[model samples]
Target: MSGSRNPRTAVVTGASTGIGEEYARKLAERGYALVLVARRAEAIERLAAELSERHGIDARTLPADLTDDADLAQVEERLSADGTGDDAPIDLLINNAGRGEGGTFTKMDPDTIDAMLSLNVRAVLRLARAVLPAQIARREAGEHGAPLGVINVASVAGELTVNPHGSVYGGSKKFVTLWSESVALEVAKHGVHVTVVLPGYVRTDMTRDVQDKGLPDFAWIPKERIVRDSLRAWAGGRTKVVPGAQYKAADNLLRVIPRSVFKSVARRFG
Candidate 1:
């Protein structure tokens, strides 16, 4: 994470827990060196050690908040090289560092909204931009045309009509989903693959709290299955993979329904 590693390295943000942790583990299983990043240094370092012991792969823990410009620059610098040298290109980048905040828009704290948007949207795109030039360069060199996969973890809320309490969170994820799709098309011919993973209520510490507060059953999904399905989709070159059958069905429905009617149904269901 701090220092550069092999060109086959995979950088996974928010790698301390949830789906990000699963992605790190699975990628290690597939023999990729990892740059595991998260706010908590100890947790990510422990995970790195565990992964190294189990898979014999290199795992570096970079403890930095993605919202910080300095921290983001550290990552960007490690992934970039001068025009004279092409040494450390990130083969896979997983932009999985984001959060969800719920409440009425007017009642929400302005600072919280700003921070959420900064981390969820700004950091996601900036990180992608920092690494893309190197990826494109590698593709142009015809170096195996080895796959460069970028997985953006969006949300089921991105595909649904706005929920009163989840409006801002939903809007941010919708940005991720749309931006990923457009960028995937831009990079596909260059041998770079991009996927936006729209997960539906994955069971993490975050969802546990939401459920404890009595959110509806339709809103909770198992995290393991989400990870499994997403890893499969990422490996198979899928541009967008929505986890869970219910979420898939719901997405398909939202596709055809009128926005006004969909909004009404979503409010009642949520």
Candidate 2:
């Protein structure tokens, strides 16, 4: 997708901060016109101005809370819109808007659970669905321009066998991981790419509480690295990317560890 001939545009949810902000900067650096989406209108507008000034790219702001049906539908409509005249086709989508609550499922509030499901599951699925059909059609018609792709931001928490404190968050991300890989397989032949990114303890507002908990330095990954690695993976036509070597090793260990062992550990620590 990088360095391709077509005028590339990307719609990035949660683009006001953290991983999503990093993605917007990196993509702008790569010459992609951006539609930055987030709930905070002021923040995204500020970012759009900064990115536009710095990169000289067309950076537009779309302030929408993805959990709201009306707002989410607006974003979906933008993704599904045709590229006519100045409105270029969105060649990339970054599904990065999500929320997580740390608690057992039974103890979590009903509204919180619904919000998590709506943003992490429903929003991701719908946004991807919105962007794919046009991409597939362009490919089938033999327009070999810039590649069309979607990058989903999941978490290492999803890969854990037992996450008592974040069961709902982990489960939501697990859905993202599974669904992204499945869609990657389904869309590959049509020249569309889907890549899921799993990160551990990134330095973001979302992880500020965990950062305050004093985890080892090695456990944390920079948001820039996550965006960089994810885009590289997507450009290379890879299905999944786990950023940070420590997390990569941990992901490998988790896959091999016994579920019974994790269950015992969860019982002791949960």
Candidate 3:
């Protein structure tokens, strides 16, 4: 169900499915006009129409593979455009496009590694850079929300010694987590927020295929809860958010563990 109409808008990458889809749903529920980005044009357009019809809000689809340089640039350009001038300024950006590749850092295919970096890291930074100027400008103009923000859908793997299975993936997310925190501080004085959400095992199509990657049934949380918890933390001014109580504890544990020990543990059990 939709909430009262809001003049604000949001751009959500990877909005066709999984956590990204949930973000689209929840943001639409709160009345934000949406720009949904994903690789499948038909899929995203259908989602857009459903959201628009359900919520009485604008929902447009921009289909692009985040790994393609040209495609990535288009998404950024659209964000910059929607973030300024007459249309409802893009009040939120959910940088949720990512690739979860299987295999250890060493055994991973080079092409897959490259694709992961392009989508999981480069696209996120480029898109954020494009939209932030406008988001900050609007907030400084005494916008009621004060700070327009970007939510980077990072992973719990970012903070762990997640090798063997997800080393490169974890490394890329580590970049996202740190980058969000750094930019979050840089924009804090201007009331612009940046949140990096580290979610644990979430039951999405991606995870279903990677069930043997050490995620247990008990640890798996539904996709909806992850998105909901993340939005709450972001809106409540948190710079970093871990959605699950179990993952929250794990994140804390990783904080004090030494790199050597982490590596040892990863090799033996993970």
lDDT of 3 by residue, 33-64 (tens): 89999998998999999999999999988899
Task: Provide C-alpha RMSD values for all models, in order.
Answer: 3.8, 2.1, 3.5
Expressed as tens digits, the lDDT of each residue in 129-183 for candidate 1 is 8888777776676555347768899987877676643778989999999999999
Better of 1 and 3 by lDDT: 3
Per residue, candidate 2 scores C-alpha lDDT tens digits across 36-95 of 999999999999999999989999999999999999999998998656545677889999
Model 2 residue runs over 4 Å out of place are 1-5
TM-score of 1: 0.89
Clashes of each: 0, 0, 0
- Per-residue error (Å), model 1, residue 58: 0.6
The candidate scoring highest on lDDT is 2
Clashing pairs in 1: none
